[model samples]
Target: MVSDGANNTMAFPRETVLKVASLARLQLTPEEVDLFATQLGATLDYVARLDELDVSNVEPMVHAIELTNVLRDDVLVPSLPRHDAVANAPKTDGKYFLVPAILES
Candidate 1:
């Protein structure tokens, strides 16, 4: 939104939005950009209003499913053998199966 001159509106066209997204390495279509601009504005407005509320002692919740850790007997049971477990793994070196790195290089 930093403008090169004064008195400029931050508003942008749908095509410009698509081009900006392309520069951002995104491939959103013109229609998608229009939809996103509307949704994004609404989302930002909602978040702005959330700051007006004072939630000082509100306990953060994990899920509203109303279910806690599933209970089970504390007793342990035999599991798959170590060799059998690693039989089909693509790579196993340190007594564990190694998986591909999730992060891009």
Candidate 2:
């Protein structure tokens, strides 16, 4: 267990820490596990404290600043021909670019 500045405490068990580390594909040393257990406990405690705030009158907002769609009007534009587009390609099979196979059978 660890305490946040607001007096709230949260338990960060070793099993839970190990599970999180495994899910994230991380390799943590025993020393790192102990360090993260305390850190994650305090973080969870701080987040738990947010539940005590009054938000009944608050409106849901997607972002802190006001936002509006700023997209440009859709319009047809000139484009390079397929041959021109492939001109700079390192390897091309006339109509498409080719690359080395990336996977093993």
Query: Candidate 1's residue-wise lDDT over 1-105, tens digit each?
Result: 322323223244465677678899998866778776665545555456668878888987878886878999999999999988988888997379998898999
* TM-scores of all predicted structures: 0.36, 0.47
The local distance difference test score of model 2 is 0.80
Compared with the true structure, model 2 gives a TM-score of 0.47
- Give a tens-digit lDDT track for model 2, residues 1-105: 435434323367678889999999999999988777777777876678779989999988988887898788799888999999998999998799999897977
Q: In angstroms, how far off is 8's CA in candidate 2? A: 12
Model 2: ten consecutive residues of lowest lDDT: 1-10
Identify the candidate with maximal TM-score: 2
Give candidate 2 misplaced runs (Cα > 4 Å).
Answer: 1-10, 56-62, 66-105
lDDT of the candidates, in the order given: 0.68, 0.80
Residue pair clashes in candidate 1: none
lDDT score at residue 88, model 1, on the 0-100 scale: 84
